[model samples]
Target: MLSIAMSTLRERWVAFVVSLVALALGVGIIATIALVMNSALTGFPGQRAALTGTVVLLSVSAGVTGFATVFIVASTFALTVIQRTRELALFRLIGATPQQVRRMIVIEALLLAAIGCVAGVVISLVGAPVLASVLASSGLAPSWFEVSISPVPLVLVCLGGMGLTALSVSVASRRAATIRPTQSLRESAGDPPGARPGRSARTGWGVALLLISLMGMGVVAAVLPELATVPVVYLWVLLTLVAAVALLAPALVLPVLRLLTLPWARGGSAIGTLVRENTLTMARRTAATTLPILITAGMSISLLGALETIGHAQSVEAGERLRADYVLVPEGGPAISAEALDRARKIPGVRIAPLAPTTVQVTGEAGLADGFWGYATDAQRFAAMTSLPLIDGTLEDFGPGGIVVSDIWELGAGQRVTVTPDGGKPVQLTVAAVVGDSAGGGDFYLDVSDTGPRPAEAAYVQAGGEAAAALRERSGELGASLLTKAEWAATVGNSDQGTGVIGMLVTLGIAIVYSCIAIVNTMVMAATARRRDLTLLRLLGATSRQAVAALLAESVVIAAAAMVLATAASAINFAGLLAALTQVVPGATLAVPWAPVLAFAATSALLAILATTLTATAAVRTPAPLSE
Candidate 1:
């Protein structure tokens, strides 16, 4: 059996080679992500603790990193498996038995997995100590992190990754199996769509998926009560992605190609014809590449929307509850000081109302609010000036030591919640009515008296945007911040630290891999199809540059149209995530990060052009097609 398997693989080495390479890249990606995140987070707690000895930051950072990584891994794996269809099909055609083919694929994946795992461990081992040393040198703490490698988790990670690879390879193998053995004599290998599966099965999958989406959304609406809108919305949008990718790919390409003709179709007849002609010919491969992009765009956009909504909501909650023109503070960043407030109240356009601010650590599993101390005063008239709505418990609940909170905190209502106070125990506080004050963006609020006589100073201030600006200008040397509602909106909305840079990095990282591989494959396939055509084009007076342009123009059309689909998917996804956020985060509102989306889309398009520019070499200058 072993001899037969090796002999079969030798004959069908192309598919086997392709499968191994694809699987290696995917498994390597998964293992690397795990390795990177673990290495990054492993030292995070120790570093932060060394600096401040505050354990809370450790939890918060760890939570955020972990949550984002989970989603990133999912997106990466899904993209990886989808790109290996042709290679998988080729394996079945090479006289390898189905079981043997499967084993070969699995073994290839395992080899890659083992290699990736070892590489990752090596990275952590070598890199962690260096990072710790740097932190110590920088005066951060008890002088660096201990070198520790928890073998158990790494082993588990390897096992889990291998399992995913096996499963994905198995599922994708169906495409290969559909190719009739007799067809191997006539065709090179099963292409992107491969052998068409039975219609009934496709229909069954589409219908079942649609139904599941509808049912899931309906169930979410029924079970989550106040949060019903959110989950339902998410379910609906996710279904939209599934349905579009599954049902639309094969049939929709040519139609979209014709549509691309509308631009140059008016006058540049040659360009228009080239664009349409190219797309019509290469839709399947283009569509396959475009599908993953659409999903990522949708997911990223949707999640971004959720985050924006939550931020705005929190702001409104904070603004509505605090009505001060200025948060008079001394020289420090978070806590308020008496000397600072006295000077601030003397400033122009400054009406200091019952000034109050307290340093209290919000303890929640989700870290719903920003990492900081909660501040409160006897309601801001400026907040009223900004039109922050009081949807729940009144601002009247706010007084010295009597605090008000947004309605999202109802979880701890009427119960003693432990909080780290500036100069006291983890005091327990009674629940106050949760309210929406998105205009101010406050995560938590506290009464002045709750401050417990540590100091007589201003922690918060309320002022109009103009007034805030004037104050900053006149006393820019005061070394403090004074922000109006509009400024705050733009500021909080734009803060980079929320989703953090690492999230985008991971997304782009996987996307780059997908784009590179897919482009290479497309070029390879296109070259094969257009061998004679290209030779003819070269003979017909087209320069190498012109040929490159034509190829890129084709790529641009495909990428741009696909990006639009991705954008639309993202929009819907964002709306769904917002609905979920509405229930989970107080004052959560939908936010669309258009700038990032556009930037990303533009980059992908450019990359596509570059891809064609580099790979078009085969068609640009070669007159004779290479004979296999």
Candidate 2:
């Protein structure tokens, strides 16, 4: 059987080449992502350490990329195996047992996996430096950081690749095992295996997983709010939702395609009707192509949605926290001095409030890092110049013995908390008020008198007329620079936006590239599969233009099916995330980044159509008799 498999492979190597390349590239990408993620986990820069959420984002990226790779590779193997139906059927007709046939297919697949895995590992090693450079340039990693080739990740990823290939081929081999000898020779043999099992079983599993995730989240939010914010927990829910979409997509594809073609089906040109009919008939082919697009769009949109929502929320929080017309921050490294504050206040028409920002460790029950960002400012001036909406008590109640806390602290008015500052003894202070949360934990506000006169990190100034001009001019003397409210808001918002955009672009780039490859591979093989049918149509009076139209229509249907599935998946993911976030974060809101979503849809559709049309062009050119 092994020798027979080798002989079969030698004869059909051309058909197998695409599968090999797809497997290699897919595994290469997965390995590269694993390497990058490992480096990030081990070598995170110390200078900017603040639990900045970059790690979680990178981990999400790695997971999404890995999932895409596995799906693409699986689809490739299924397509490859199906293309060999005639050969498998021939073996069966020659009195080969089903067990021998299965073994033959598995041996060929294992051979391909061995070759592909080596190529993929090599590609990963060669690509590591480029990956590291991109990360460094994007400011994701420090300049001093370099890619370290870890043997453990490489070996593990290779093993994963082999395992994934084995699973894919095993499933695909079922078709070989079940097909009758005569049917294989007569049928087109393009449809993938495993289309008829308990689709209900898959659907049931999907729904069960989604329900469990939602219920689990609700229970966690109600009982243990602390664990609700863990990134891995959210990641697990996200993975479950994506898995549900994958399981549900095949069931949904046909109905959605039918609905979309209704207009053409009703009263359309002959060519359009013919095109629509062909697309509807070959639902499996359309689905095979659509699956990649679905994965790409769903993952990109969901991840981008979460990032944009968080960024927007942060921006809104920053804008609402202060009512100052202008803010001054030190240009160099030094903090704003008392003299600078006095001088700014002495300026005409200026109402200046200086703030001293620091981080502290809570020494009592409330001494948690969640609400440790502390700031000291003049009580009356702070209240007058900022829009810190109080949840209880009044900002005017803040004094030398009192402090203000954000809602994150969960402490009520008149509650006492102890804090230990850098190089200082523990101090006990009464909570004068609790305010709504802000971007940077605007928690733990203390009277400057109580904390002693510390250097000011920033000052909020309300100045108009010539006072603004005077403050701007004296900014150099005050060792600070002045920015208007809009500039200040932008300054506060831009960093998060930059990070989110970079992450989105990186994810989008990877998805688009892999999806295009999958689209091209699927369409070409599908076009090849239908060559006889298309050639027969040409023989039976169908014009070349009409044949091309049919192919384009099929492509559009596939793309449309993908778009629908992707949107459904993204919506489910976003809803779950928003619900979970609202439970943990006080003011979380649903904000869809529609532009990227639309862009993904358009690009996916365009790529699918163009790839199918290009491949079909060649089919239309082939002489009818030669097509067989």
Candidate 3:
């Protein structure tokens, strides 16, 4: 039995190759991500110390990016495995035992997985400082960031990935085992493997998951509010997306059918009729492709939402907290002129209240070392006229002997701290309060009289009523500076919310298209191989057109069904991924935008129409002779 199974591999090497390649790609990504994450964890501290500051948000960027990277890799790999169905079917019929099939996939996958791991580790080994340099230039990171892949985890990642690759291949191979040996020995499996979920069935699962996902989130949030926030939100989006795919796919066919039947549609009813009929035919193929579409679409929702959230944090939110409508500083300060301030005041809705201009040395938290930043403000006016929320201490804290720091400034309320403001005297101040800040960036609110860093001073002003445009005009005229709440918001809106979503959509769109092409090619080949059968049908008086339409309708049906299943799967996995991300990334939330989901479903339906039409074109041209 073992020999027979093993022999089948040589006979069907291509099948094993497909699994190996797909599995290796997945393992490679997993290994690389693991290595990077480990290096990130290990190096953050040294990097932290070298760039020591008054505070650090230990839970932000590193964790979040890591989690996202993992999901992107996993989805990519799964899609790859699914695309190569033909090769797998052949091996089973050739007498390959499942165990032997599994081994062949694992061994080959291991080799490729190792190479990817090595490449990732090496790149990280080399790329850290190039990154640090860019950060330093941008004034974001200090000059002393230590970036390198440490020995411990990097090695572990490589080892672990091989194990994981083998495991994934083994699991996937077991499913292929159910393929009837004789049937598979003859030809490839259908584009997608399954049938459609009935409306009730899809709805039941969709509703169940939706409820469970939501309930789980509510419970988690009520119990662990902070941790649950981003995680719960992500799960919510994931569930919603799944339900949309499930509950929506069957319903999707009608729209596609309607689209094909539309009076104003591009092609005439014959082409359109054929297209519509074919859509119902390759339902399985369409559905399989929809899986990738769902991933891409679902991810787009999250990415866009993230960008929007981040952008909002940078702009509208940042501006509201800035509190100062305009700032007027001495010509000698950071250079805001009186004319600029006056012009700002002249703008519509402009109102100027008070100004506080003073200086405080900027130093790292706990006096860790490095350079300094200067804060210019008059304590009394600044405190009274700002939107800064005193979450912890009080306003009395903003003095040479007292202070309030940003939320991320990891210090106890009563802790005493001393720092040489701008390389000056190490003045000690007690923590009075910690103020709330909107954006994740760091800054301090304290009253200190020091001029250590660049003098170029900055003056704060309160202005209302259309002061923004006036400030801009004045800045251009007086050669000074002004930034309005809206202008400032636009400038700082880094994530640009939905702006980046197009890229994700395009990428996903391309993937779905590629899948469609694969389906077309597969169907065309299958039809070509069945020329004798088709010829017999043609002889039986089944018109080539009708035969083509029937085949197309079958494809549409199967693809549609697969699409239904995929939608359901997307909900499950996407939720799991979000939960993991929430555990890993700080402040990362999952939000599903309905528009994108609907768009993807519709897109899949359209592609199925295209694929079916294109696939039938080959067979319709010539009827094969019936005698086999």
Candidate 4:
């Protein structure tokens, strides 16, 4: 069986090569992510909170990429087995038992996986350092962070890759093993059957996955609404939906292709007819090719779109929360000088609220021991300058002896919590109010007297009409940069957001690269496997140019279907995310990064076109064989 598997692999190297490459890329990405994450986890001690976001990002990336890898590998193996239907039938005719056939297929998969995993590990050796640098430069990790080389992770990844391949092949092999030799031989002479035995089962699984995804979204929206903005939650939901779409892809391919190719199909051109018929006749192959593009386009749009939506929501929320007419920020220092605040307050009709940002250590609660960020300000003036969402008590209750804590702390009104201010002694203060979590806002608020003599980080001024202009001029004279409420909100919204987005993009880059490789590999494999069909077209009086054109048109149809399905997936993901966000951040709108999405779609289409046309052209140029 091993020798037979080796011989069969050599004979069909072109098809197996695609599977090998896909598996290799998958393993490489997983390995690299593992090494980097291991380093991040071990390198940061006592600063885990600071590295929490980065680690989460890495974990999500690994999970998504791993899912995609398994999916692509399974699809590749299924297609490869299906394409070898005739060969497998011949083996059965020669007295090979079903068990033997299955064993041979498994052996072939293990062989391919073994080689692929080794190559993948090599790829990771070079990729880890580069990825580490990206994380450090993006500020997601410390500059001193480095990938720690460990044989344990590498060995485990290799073994895991092999195991995954074997498992995927086992499932795919069942069909090949069960098919009657005569039926397979007959089917191989023409287009493979469109409907398979387990199609209903596949549909059931797909529907079940989709239902699970929706249920998850509903649960998040109704319960943990704050998690809507968390990338891992939405990303997992998106990938689940993508998997459902993938499972249902064969059923989706024909209908979508027909609609997408309507103009070309209705043109009464022979090439168009051939293209439509070819893709529809081999819907499984078309679906397989479409999966990569679907993943690429869907993921790119969902990740980028979600980031934009969340960022925009935060920005809008910030602007809406402030009732101030102008904001004054110090130009050259961390804190605004008392002289600047004095001058700003002297302006007539202007009420100023100076916010002194500081950190405080809490020794009472178990989790609160890491210290909390808060602001010291004149409670009365602060209440007048902003409309904070308060869950308990009122802004008026916030005074010299009282503190306002975020609801996240679970501190209720009138509860006493001991907090030590930076450079100050521990003091117990009463929680006068509990405010909802607001982005870019402190976790707690304290009166200036309780927080020592800290200077204001920024001042909020409630001034309108001529008072606003006068305050702005006065701010200039004091060498402080003055911005209107809208301008300041925009600045706050944009701050510290890019680091996260960049980190996510860096992680997503791995998946995108793998998807691109899969796209090319699948297209080339699909095209090359159709040498017989191309030869038939040539024998039926079609020119090489016509054959290639038809193939290219079919590739376009598949790419179009992929893009359409990807758009739907992304829209579904965005809708679910927005539903959750609306529960947390009211009036959250969808933010689609159309330019990047379109660019990625175009690139996917172009790769599909080139791979199909180039491979089809070569296949058609070969003379038809006189016998099988």
Best model per TM-score: 4
Which tens-of-lDDT digit does each residue in 234-268 have in candidate 1? 33345354454443444544566567667776666
Whichever of 3 and 4 has more lDDT, that candidate is 4
lDDT tens string, model 3, 327-391?
44333232444445455546666444323222244457575554423253445556655665567
Q: In candidate 2, how many Å is residue 31 off? A: 2.9
For model 4, residues 366-428, the per-residue Cα lDDT tens digits are: 564767888988787888778887899888888888899987777899889888998798888
Error of 1 at 177 (Å): 1.6
Model 3 / residue 181 / CA error / Å: 5.9
Could you give the C-alpha RMSD of every candidate to the true structure, in order shown?
A: 7.5, 5.2, 9.8, 4.3
Error of 2 at 572 (Å): 4.0
The TM-score values for the models, in the order shown, are: 0.65, 0.77, 0.53, 0.85
- Which of 1 and 2 is the better model by lDDT? 2
- Sorted by TM-score (best first), the order is 4, 2, 1, 3
> Worst ten-residue run, lDDT, model 2?
225-234
Q: Residue 4 of candidate 2: its Cα lDDT? A: 82
Q: What is the lDDT of residue 168 in candidate 1?
A: 48
TM-score of 3: 0.53
On a 0 to 1 TM-score scale, where does candidate 1 land against the true structure?
0.65
Better of 1 and 2 by TM-score: 2
Of 1 and 3, which scores higher on TM-score? Answer: 1
Candidate 2, residues 262-377, lDDT tens digits: the string is 88888877766876776565554555567777776776677667656655555566677778888888776447988778878888899877788766677444544433767888
Clash count, predicted structure 1: 44
